[model samples]
Target: MSRRRPTVSTSPSWTVGDLTVHRVDEIPLPPATGAWLLPAATPDVVTGHDWLHPHFADAQGVLRLDSHSFAFVLDGLRVVVDTGIGNGKERANPAWHDLDTDYLGRLTSAGFPPDSVDLVILTHLHADHVGWNTRHENGRWVPTFPRARYVTSRTEREFWAGYAMDEARAQMFRDSVLPVEEAGLLDLVDTPADGATILPGLRLLPTPGHTPGHVAVELTSRGETAVITGDCVHHPVQFAAPAVGACVDIDPVRSEASRRALLGTLADTDTLVLGTHFAPPTAGRVVRHEGAYRLAPVPPVAPVAPAPVAP
Candidate 1:
């Protein structure tokens, strides 16, 4: 059976008091190459194999380009949640090498200026999550958002700072991470395991296992809340098989536990979930159906057209 490409849509400007949420569109991964690796030691979550067909062909698979970075506008602060794969980096994976992302323009177009971004929250220290941390300058790595203070978990920072020197992961730290540290912009945050309020409406929650110190950001205002799941639950398949863990997960068993607990909490709540790699319309709510969990895609908001003048 052939699979249809997912359609894209944008939600109306959602406001939580003074904070506004906007989704930036990035390139989409080709179908045939998107579904390469299954969770290392876990059962296939997106069963039927139909859902996996598009991303693979003749043993070759592709990860979809639905990769995204989110922007949150709060009280006098433009906070960029995560920076997508950036340009001019030496990546071990050829697919991510020397990539150019129009993230700056996407931010500006969405009403937040790149330079105006006051804080950058890195959910983890992975290559894709921290790619835009810096830019090349004078043959050196420099802070990409000159005015923003880059934030990461203390454990995550320490782990990568040492692990980055290793052959396989060193390039990740060199071109994508260390540059921000060298620029005095990196802020190591020590957040509680359950969750903690970062700002008035923004909170941080530890959902580790994918990485030891990984976290998910939650924004709430006047009862309206949304969570940036980061990489805790990468693909929609996990919604059905919460036990399945990504191959790269540092602790698959622990990660599965975290995913299950987190999903359970939001299962019946009003929280809108924002996943970094969940195709398009990256924002949605978790609903219980057929005695199993499912991801219900949020409908896109219709664009407001200009008013008609006297004809």
Candidate 2:
């Protein structure tokens, strides 16, 4: 299947009390990405859940995933949840190799420019999630958010540090992860069983399995709450079948356990769930459905248009 062009406006935002969470636009992954990423989500399995059609998946059951980042401001600190694939990066996957997109422009348009960012919360050190950590400049990869502190779990950083990496992963670290580290911008936090409160209302929930030290971000304010799922729950179809695991999951059994646990808490709640890779109408409320779970779609509030000025 061919790639679908972005149909939505530049920056779509959702409200969680006083905070306005923005979804900056990036390139949408090809339809084939679903099959390769989540082989467990076969056509038959996807079609079984009629609710997924026309939004999360095509009528033919091809899963729709995107590459974008979530941005918001908390307590005077400008935050970027994850950085999608960056421009001019080499990778083994053809879909993510040496491509270009106006990701930074979208971020700037959303009111969270690179230089103004104070914190970058990375759920893991995956290539796509960390791609925009650096940008090609003057024949060198430099930290995009020079002023921000890039954060990830200590376990995550330590795991990769001790492991033998392939050419592709090593290359990703060299360009995207290393530049930030060398600039003294990367910070590794210890995520405990009960999770860690990074700020007044922001917390890091340990939902490892996709990676040993992977985490899901939780934001609470004025009694309202939301969770930003990294890769733990890639598509809403996983809500129906939490057992279905991704192909790249470092630990499949543990991954499903984490998904099931996370979904159990989220089921039948008012808490908003923001998917890291979900397509348009990305955020939603989770509710019990046929003994499982499903996302009751919550479309983002349209960005207010600027007032017209007299010529």
Among these predictions, the greatest TM-score belongs to 2
Model 1 alpha-carbon drift over 4 Å, by segment: 1-18, 30-34, 40-65, 302-311
Name the runs in model 2 displaced over 4 angstroms.
1-10, 305-311
Which 10 consecutive positions of candidate 2 have the poorest summed lDDT?
302-311
- lDDT, candidates in the order shown: 0.70, 0.90
Q: Which pairs clash (backbone N, Cα, C closer than 3 Å) in model 2?
A: none
- In candidate 1, which residue pairs clash? 28-65, 29-64, 29-65, 31-54, 33-61, 33-62, 33-63, 34-62, 34-63
Error of 2 at 10 (Å): 4.2
Task: Please provide, for model 1 over 28-101, each residue's C-alpha lDDT reduced to its tens digit, 9 standing for 90 to 100.
Answer: 54453234433331234343334333331122323343656887666667788888777787887666678877
Per the 3 Å backbone cut-off, how many clashing residue pairs does candidate 1 have? 9
